[model samples]
Target: MLIALSFAVGGLLHHLGILRIDHLPPLHAHFRVPTFRLLPAAVFGLAAAWMLPGALARLRFGRAIALGYGTALAWTVLLAVSGDGLAAPFTHKEEYLAVLPAVGDDPSGWLAGFTEHLPGYPTHVRGHPPLPVLVVWALQALGLPGPLWAALLVVLVGCSAAVAITLTVRRLGGEDAARRALPYLALTPASVWIATSMDAFFAGVGAWGVALLVLGRKRWSRLLSGAGAGVLLGSLPYLSYGLVPYLLIPVVVAVMVRPSRLTVAAILAGAGSVTAAFAAGGFFWPDGVLATHAQWAADPGAARPYLYFLFANIAVLALVTGPAATAGLVGPIPARVRTVVAATLVAVAALDVSGVTRGEVERIWVPFAVWVSVAGGFAGGRAGGHAGDRRWLAAQVVTGLLLQGLVASPW
Candidate 1:
């Protein structure tokens, strides 16, 4: 559950980047087109999210690393075979545009650099991090062919992100909450687009960070969790700007609503680590901080559809999920929260359709989704709350899926 929350936050924070389907700038001037070698970089990230933690901390490092990488190798092999045969298509055309990349920009000779890999188009723009870049390279080493390699990486990452989300939901509210979100994350339009490529890796990392945040203030645990999350968070923007602030909003909001040493430390450590890494030029290469600012400075469309839709989506997801949730729980939450949340979502949809942010998808509304689930999780009452809760959750999930049907399908 903690992990799922992180993924949700990550998904939420970076929703902005998802809308920019038309043209995304290259990661930076120094970042050459990611060679096919980046394919492996994609899967290894998921491995870290899936495997690490208790075992790595307690068991032999070598064994843990080997086991994780070894399993990924197996999965890679499975996909390599299927991809060679054209396998399946699980994403939208807009996503294809992102993956296809513009023809000539791929001069890095990515195709030749990695063996079991895919040939990616030379991208003129920048988004996403090198976590994917390096993993892509590793996948190339696994004996996969070019064309299907990238797609394979995406599926693997999607699985990882899904896992993280599931765990986080379970952690926060319970199994019910996690189930409520599972279908949404896996089957949603935007999620499907992201699922077919290596985009899930970023979301997974963001989810882990959220898990740490929920762990709250426990000193050593807090420091380690926060530090690790920071490095990943800092590295994330490079991969995709949408991830940066998506998760941060709830974190910021929660912390502000009830400040705690743990929350504060988590925020500072994660953000600071990212800063330190960039300053040292480790996570970000060449231009470093200057390049980052330059890119942000150039972002004229920083706020599209504004913050309205995000709020709306969150409310919609919550209001319908579980009756217990609809009742607004015992805390400070009120019934009006749902009304306001729903209104915001409507406004966002109208804005997007009326020439604001086009191509709305699940990723764009992830934060809202997460909040709804969290609310659902908390909605379960003490003694006899199951009946109402189940009915409410069913209504929400069904309704949400139907709403998605109305929107452009990710398929």
Candidate 2:
């Protein structure tokens, strides 16, 4: 009973607090996150879900909460290695470069805030700031240390995703579908793109938030889940503006049409907090930020179109807001609501395909991709099939994870 209560309480706290912590830091802070990408964890996040649902499910409530928290922390460390510790893609480099000039002429000034800076650059942040920045910022009000912040990030950045993928796969596709889907993610180039780029974790937070909301069984659970999703989604643009289309577009459409109060509240709260944070950080809407980003991407390696990338994202928008999302719906939302989502998705797809999809920085589409991958798992589950095939598919995903873990960067 205690364990169940803790899960309920912790769920509420995690859901509510992520927004508070996620909002505290400056946008540029995330650009300097340390690289700690341990691709094995990404692989684990997908691969472990099959086992965990049972293991954690069977545990005492306290044990289950403890077990879940432990897993969350462990995963954060692995993903952290890939983010800020390494170099970033072209459009992404600018987020750091903008602030670089401001802090330039005196590298020590910036270093004062961080005792251990990334190697190579002179007073420069390697990639986007670690996902922990906002989490730490939330802790700052409580006087948490950097190392502790990093550890906390392991939970916020790591488990949010790991559990999300697990639940999404299980709920949508079932155990069989989840097992089948694991292998492909292990070797995808996009996964490589995601881990290496710093923005992936923030996007993961957003996705998990959505997943949590969907999985929540009670009204309070729904509220908390939505809150988590809101914080994660809102945090994305702060790390990389490129994620907006994927993160914001789908979320808006989903919320506009969804029947529940929790989902609506989560979106509103998270977005509102982020907006307040952005304004507080001085990145006013309709300001030089847009103009500056436009000019920066105009050069070589500019935001050119990637057919696969667009197709993948379009598929995600379709899956997330389309029939797949409908599958996640428990009670029926109004017909008008579903119609609006359908229309909005169509419009976004039109804009995305027409080469209007510019200013895309790094793998900004990752959050959406995460959504797509989960949606795929769901869609795969919904197909009229058998238990044997599902298990076979899951075995393949598990095998892929093992193989990818042995090789470089498991996406």
Candidate 3:
């Protein structure tokens, strides 16, 4: 119902000429000639939806992580291949790889002048920090070059977000909640973007940062885990300016866990180290934010009507999260899980109302989307019961397959 309403609203806006999107409303995608390529993924998703919920209930924690991650990875790859083949990651003109050649051999020099050269770069490059391009550039320097390697790196790392989210849920809500959430995390509609978009890489990194922070609250590994979380969280701003709002996620984690002062200090030290290193390399975080904001404001796409997207963005979120998550939002969730969901929503709402992210949130907000979708784990009966869980999981899988078959997205 929410999904249909979103499209209907988007269609009306498009018809009225009030929406400035280049592609279809509510999504940055076009209707494609339907293809049989989606059939294999459909079959796989149905099988997992039917089987994994029960199997995950009985599996050991270690084995569950392995199985869950492997299944999620396979699902993302199949969906991505179904849409654009192995070349999907680099296919878009605005993607990071498209502008990799522009970075040249002098990374330090480029980092120093990133803001000055921002306007001349491609759309995706100009709108983001230097980290994404730097990752691709590092791959090339390591002899693991080209779009295929970059795409593989992204999918591999991106799919791991499922594991990270699962771990965080387990820490906060217990093993049952974590186990229940696994299928949704693995089979989310968000996988459509996670398969090919660089934003998926950001989602994975941000999720693990929170996961580590919660997991690190223990006495033995506080320093190591806090430091790890800090570095990953700190690096997020450089990945996407939009992720600056993502700080709320970690703040929520910190409050929930109530870490010792040493743990907190370790986190600050780790984050400060990244800030220092970047400053030494000439890419101050504040400059990147200002420059990206300027670039975004000047882009014609930013001209879309804010009034329409203010609501339509929620619709796109529904599409990405699917019915299970939507239902879970109202279900009886654990306080910790609910708190995390609330924090993510606050961040997303802040972004939506700010008029900075007018559309394409289906891909751009992947990091927050995963957390929002965590509500799905609580939608069914208590941890051990299968009651309504499988049905909702099936709905999520079908939603992904339908989206892949029906629309051709920019990712």
Each candidate structure's TM-score, on Cα atoms with residue i matched to residue i, is 0.47, 0.49, 0.96
Residue-level lDDT of model 1, residues 208-317, one tens digit each, is 55555544456676567666665555565555544444544335433433435664666677677665654444343434334433443445434433453334333333
User: Which ranges of candidate 2 are over 4 A from the true structure?
Assistant: 1-162, 168-190, 248-259, 303-362, 375-411
6-37: candidate 2 lDDT, tens digit per residue: 22433353356532221111100121322234
Which RMSD does model 1 reach against the true structure?
13.4
Query: What is the lDDT for 391 in model 2?
Result: 43
Candidate number with the higher lDDT (1 or 2): 2
Estimate, for each residue in 258-375, the C-alpha lDDT of model 3 and write its tens digit: 8889988989998898899899999988888888888888887688888878888888888888888988887778789889999999999998999888888888888988998889
